[model samples]
Target: MHWSTLVDAVVVAHQPHSADPARYDIVLGAGVRSEESLFDLPAAPRFELFAGTTVAAASAGRCSAVDGLFKPRADPAPVPMELIGCEPAEPLLAALRRPRRSERNWVHLLVLDRHGAEMASRTVGLAITGARPSVLGGTLIDITLTDGGDERPSLAARPIWAQWYQGPPAEPNLWAPYDTQGRAAWLDLTTRAWRVPAPRPDRSGGEHHLDGRFVTDVPGLHCAIAEALLGPGRYFGREWNAFKDCLCGGFGVAPPFTLTWHDAEIARRALADVVEDQEDGLSYFEDIVRLLERYGVTVVLR
Candidate 1:
């Protein structure tokens, strides 16, 4: 029935060329949903790469294909991703380099069945990439699951997103205007999220971030993001408002935002007056942090 494959265990290690790739060095083990051996089975099944946490990968990078997605890192001819294995069953691990952040990476190493069919196509979670217990003092580590189990996983889930649109928005990613006729069009999006950046450039009137909390991104950074994405009306426009509205919530969808460590660090070190003001009725920023967490969105550094 099956050509039977070889190689029982799956492993990912830093490529020989990686010396300083301590942070980028990654490891992976494979598991199937059907609880079958991956070693010497079918000839060649397909594979892909995606996310555990939403922010770094595409789902975490770009949920809304039409509206707004993160800036693409195109210069590096081969960006790290969906790295398919060579054979259906004998492919070995290759070196994958990524950012040095401490975020956990939930990778889907989907292995397909031999006939290019789905009945036996398996989606496996190479769940060993992130925040697991320390092993080998390696900056990046991967391990096999002690208790064998079947694995089925789809890609990219960002900060927990609550899609509340009554109808689909004219665009993707941003909140939909109304709930679709039925809840089928949208994937209930993975606000599968988590949290950004800095500074105290004073305007004498106000600040982009105030007292250990972000009122918003710095004007310059905002300008950069806006200019790059919004263009024409960099200062104000429907697109800009939609971005803020998506985070601010209440109109329809809830605020689909989360703060990262780099973000909170800036808040904590903000001017004391800004961090906690006596005259301004306790920074609402603290409240926002708590709210994000309440939604199961972790407010921590990635």
Candidate 2:
């Protein structure tokens, strides 16, 4: 598909590479870079961030009218962009020359498609928007400071969970935030094709010099959850255990945090392992759901 075909929407003026601007500070600018191939599509997408999201701008004037507890202000910062699926990438070259027609503004971005349908969207994150490694279209944005994206230079060095069993992950240790099938997947507009090394083994069986190929549980789910927790560096031994931590406490999501746990017929029987069979009460997992509500975590049991 053409690179533009892949995008659903563009939310500009975001903290470079940060999926959650509310949780992370915004870099004043995140350099965007893009390039094209004669036979293939542009390596990545590109757009410049402005002052704020349209959502924030719409609310600005209304806030001043609050009667009792209110204050008037100028240049109120834009509400942080949602990072549900986007982050910052490497900056375009330092000496970029933006087209005179391409101007920056103080607003959120959500341009519709030519068809007037919802556009394909990319999460606002760090991206390299340049034609070449050294050339830039404009003063590019930097994402090395964001915790889960290119804003933070340290992300490049983090150990991917796919190879946690090894001393360190294989060469080019980058964060693989998505689990497409069993292998780890992350967004990289630079590469000709988005492919990565195989996932680390989940177990070692009877004796063997080399590692086993089979993963103990669902590797993709684990990788996805790991990304949710900020890249793959925080892989634990088991996917289930890791999920438990997120479900109960050790992890967090955007506001109105909701967790849904599904149980099999066998899972219901396992309730014996938790609380004794309650004549009129909930199951073990259901009890956990109730407890989580006390912490303001909305858990839906299935």
Candidate 3:
């Protein structure tokens, strides 16, 4: 479970608000597992609920326990990182020297397997306000990620999750063993997975079987569907809208085929309480089947 082979480099780029982002001059080479800090999230703080009591203490009715309004996520701290053997360009140097909040930069870290094929693309806000020469003959830059925007704490995941990024397991049902928290982290990384593998020449139509044994939650369903359509460690969609985009062709497979969902009762019960659309009143599982049907895919829920 060597991690050095898990990542190739952090490709930095400037993203304009109006235009698409392109590659910038700086590329931060990956260091050993110990030197990498991009995924090193800080420990989450513990929250304490306060109990309130009145001085009178004679009322049998009115109980007052104030609701805690603690902030879910604080701004992540700056992580010190060293890029090996890369010289900064004038624009990057200028931005570092005179940092501006309005300008946007992104650090896209490409995860690779032992064979050098890309497995995922992890991104963070690149706020490099200072830099200095490093002993490794490279530039040491300060990296501070912006807010997660989804209220999740921008923290590091367990090493096991990182180890899993080496590649998808050789067998199917790769994501079935993880607990709820572990599955959430796995789904997070799955959403970041970019299709860098050589695309299949025929991404048009195919019959795919979905193993619904692990579709315990919405994210798990996404993970399962991606593996079903594409392959393990692949990404088909994140939410319903993105799933729609995938079904519209060019995302590994087109519609007009059959999908036999084996062990479908698992997902049906798991997602029975969840709803993707209120108007239809269909559960998440049913909505997914309905969406697939709309796209001309015959779904046989076994």
Candidate 4:
């Protein structure tokens, strides 16, 4: 039987790559169900097991369980382009031309809690406009200064040649003066600021800097934000810890100063209080939901 039709949901309790053992808990409704272990599923790359039920009564529950296992898949759509005249045309053009790598661009992903047991996830990418590398692209530049105070013309011997010959046969005073080169020299040409066109209005949002002070009430949002700030590899480590930590209070490490963390006890007391105490009236988890809606983050609810 096709697992998708019978299974209402699949919850991956653990992943193989994880430091912890991988396990999945199959939840079935009050009806008969069957399962098949698959080496591969084209649409779900990570899944190793397939489950479902023919009983209609339990279908919804099974679907929910399956949906919970993986993060919602994203739509890879091309971004729309808009043309706007540059205000400070010279600097703006210069900034764009500066050598930079796009892959280094930073992004944030957050996972949040839904109901008591449910979770959600999202990702957000950030870019700093109008910034460029200080040095000319791939060019190595160096500088040297000669002291004119000496009455006699200074004869300088190259250091590399001197080293290869064991020592300079002549006086030490004849050695050439050294100079700074490449990236070192590039660091010296410093400026406070440059002008670039404002980021697209649609891309910009209310300026709320996320700091440690805010408490989170949603685990999914917390996970998503953690993924966003720390990147995928680190996020996975933090995520496993966060889930276990929620069951208990201490994360062993100090609370994350970067993204939000939900206090499960606080969430149990009152969600409103959890929301209000949150910075900007949104925990890192809730922010994930909002961000996903605007930024093409896929959220699949089981």
Candidate 5:
């Protein structure tokens, strides 16, 4: 009787890290078989044997000797083998023989990024036909970035050190060290003291600490010394009123002028003069706060 046979199989190949092109190793799976060859067999053979059993034995032996099959090298690394998928041909069951050449296959290559992110994957077609051993491989992929336009000016001075003070004091304080071209500078932390640079500018420098505490070396305390004398909102409003009174007295203006007029014409000029000296000082503290934020440091500002 004549019989029809079918075979199904999957093959995979990979190059080990230590493998060199001059020498290559190949691995094969047992289930691989050719459908045309299996169909040529008779339904009832003169002798009957199990094809699966024979294939299994061959697979075991091949896998065991795989390491020895490769050329010897300074360092030999063992490559793992796997049979991912399999199927059998019907008539081939009675023959109980080794796999014919056509049924093998391999997996596609995948590329990954530096962070282990998958960048791309593509199927690589086999070059040779009816080849005995399967081949597997991989290649590296690269990423590139483009620039966008927006330019800003650089700062003349850079901050080297900064710290936030959380201890109970008049108000929250920020300390910072700045490189100001050879100028005598005193930072009021607790009090003002000279910042001495060490003999080796890079290796050592004079250090000064500031806080709310009264230190003889430092000249000024961090807190506003005349808070009680000025009272709440007194400076802001008193300065405004004084300026308005002066303007009206000078212009010979009479009463009944609206508060809005006083604010726009006279008060604005007066307040500007009062706050002029303190503007740059306040900005120094703000710059320190900005630097700390840039460095991912959390700061409590009061």
Candidate 6:
């Protein structure tokens, strides 16, 4: 079926490179109604280590700093889904009859908006584990879905996902005053907004002014920087390491540009409350300004 046929479909199975590029619908409503698992991501594993005797000292009421490590990506858990009133095409039915570990069984599960636009998508290896009769008068299929790619948004960030599902906003700084988690979610959404990499940095060395009134925290700083560099609700990076990667290329605006920051004093005091990376020995604002200078950006502070 054509892609447009699946508009407003609760769940869709898409095959992009197939001869017909079919998008099959996985209808909702009936016996299965709980959808909390669809929005949750798996917990990440973190390892923490302390110096010898540090643990003992901590037990004795002495404080000691510990080193922590985490992977960039987490191993995702399988999504248990129950589909009611699903009518599969012949090809999809044949594949589901004897599900195996094959490319044909791997499909993108798209979550659609009320208007039938894609809100979010995930690749999953689908297998029909069992089938039963729905009490409401239909077939109920139990499907076990293993993660093929893309982590789901965290619960803290689901509000942003819900907002974007309606479509992109028309204004800037909508994320202002939201705690760091919300602002971080805003940046994450920006990363997925475009299919291709961001355009090359502007070589004309144009002047981009930043409104620093809302730069109160680390993630807020990132949000302000994104809008300053790429316009409203755009993304440059979400963290310091990612920021550096954006500077090298692909995130719009190279060095030799001028950035005039307005209301800089607000961030100077507000960012002081944000404590991170004590080993860096510099405030968040200072570090950002220094990095910009190092990369050939002419920063004018007001």
| Candidate with maximal TM-score | 6
Taking the candidates one at a time, how many backbone clashes does each contain? 32, 42, 1, 28, 14, 2
Candidate 1, 69-150: lDDT as tens digits? 1123344232122222223121122312322221233333432224222111233333223223234444433334221224
lDDT of 5: 0.24
lDDT of each: 0.28, 0.31, 0.60, 0.28, 0.24, 0.62
Runs of candidate 3 with Cα error greater than 4 angstroms are 1-156, 159-161, 191-194, 203-206
Error of 3 at 231 (Å): 2.2
lDDT of 3: 0.60
Candidate 3's displacement at residue 21, Å, is 54
- The weakest ten consecutive residues by lDDT in model 6 span 54-63
TM-score of each: 0.18, 0.20, 0.55, 0.17, 0.12, 0.60
lDDT of 4 by residue, 4-110 (tens): 33333434343443343443344433222324534343563432332211121221222212543333445444332111222335433443454243223332222
lDDT of 5 by residue, 175-231 (tens): 212222200021222211111212222111122122222211111111211111111
TM-score of 5: 0.12
Q: What does candidate 2's lDDT look like per residue over 65-118, in tens digits?
A: 112111233543333332222222422222224322222312222323243332
Pitting candidate 4 against candidate 5, the one with the higher lDDT is 4
* Model 1 worst lDDT run, 10 consecutive residues: 188-197
RMSD of model 5 against the true structure: 36.6
Candidate 3 residue-wise lDDT, 1-302, digit = tens: 11122143453553333432432222334422323423432354332211111121222222121122222345556554434434577655666665665247655655566656564555654555345564555454433333222223233345435556566555667667776566666666666455555666546556788988888988788888888887776678876778888888776688878888999999999989876444456787887888899999989889
